[model samples]
Target: MHGYTQDKDEYAARLRRIEGQVRGLAKMIDNDQYCIDVLTQISATTKALQSVALGLMDDHLKHCVSEALTEGGDTADEKVREASEAIARLVRS
Candidate 1:
């Protein structure tokens, strides 16, 4: 019922779908699918994973970062900075 609980449920659902996509990709390889075809599926899986990451990052900024800022000063800024660096890494990859 709480906000965090709701966000956690959504994240779990997204991850579950990504897990299934990975398994499907394995099956595709086993079936001797073409290289391009396999690669396309892999790309899709990667995009799905990225989407999940983005969603979680959004939740982190809106909830965690916001709450930290309200309670602490430099410590909260440090957390936000760390989170920004993490997002930058994710975007690069």
Candidate 2:
């Protein structure tokens, strides 16, 4: 089975929850919640977003990377670099 098929719904649900968390965080700020509390929620949302990114990277490596490597040459290297740089950006964000 394709990697996305195994648990796509679960991943989507998690992302939805993360979206809700973000909205809640915004509401908290509007309501003047404690700074520390707002910061904590922001941190949690960041982690959640990271988790989604990591999962996407993992799937891309498993599928796109493998396919590109099989196709061969400089193209594979370029794709690998692209994926690497994307993950790096995700980490930095």
Candidate 3:
């Protein structure tokens, strides 16, 4: 199972909320809402997604990475590499 399995429901709920926010954003554009208001909402949505990403990264380090490190071999190396790549992507975003 994935590291976030324990909080799967919570993650799902959070994503759903973000989805709603995106829909609202689209509606705002359709209704010709003020530019600043729309940009503010976009910033909020981006930060919400970033928060979830950070949480998942923490969970991954605590569970998956720890387990691999305990095993101490090629698997550990791969997991570390995978995590580093993931972090890099997150940072770039």
The top-ranked prediction according to lDDT is 3
Q: What is the C-alpha lDDT profile of model 2 across 1-93, one tens digit per residue? A: 554666689889999999899999989999999999999999999899888878978888887788889998988998799898998898677
After superposition on all C-alphas, the RMSD of every candidate to the true structure, in Å, is: 2.2, 2.2, 0.5
Alpha-carbon RMSD, candidate 1: 2.2
Worst 10 residues of 1 by lDDT: 1-10
Q: For candidate 1, lDDT tens digit of each residue in 1-93?
A: 322566787788888998998999999999998999999989999999998878777777777888788989887988789788989999799
Best by TM-score: 3
What's the number of clashes in each of the models? 0, 0, 0
- TM-score of candidate 3 versus the correct structure, residues matched by position: 0.98
Off by over 4 Å in 1: 1-4
In model 3, how large is the Cα lDDT of residue 79?
Answer: 95
Ranking by TM-score: 3, 1, 2
Candidate 2 pairs with clashing backbones: none
Q: What C-alpha lDDT values do all the predictions have?
A: 0.85, 0.88, 0.99
lDDT at 61, model 2: 85
TM-score of candidate 2 to 2 decimals: 0.85
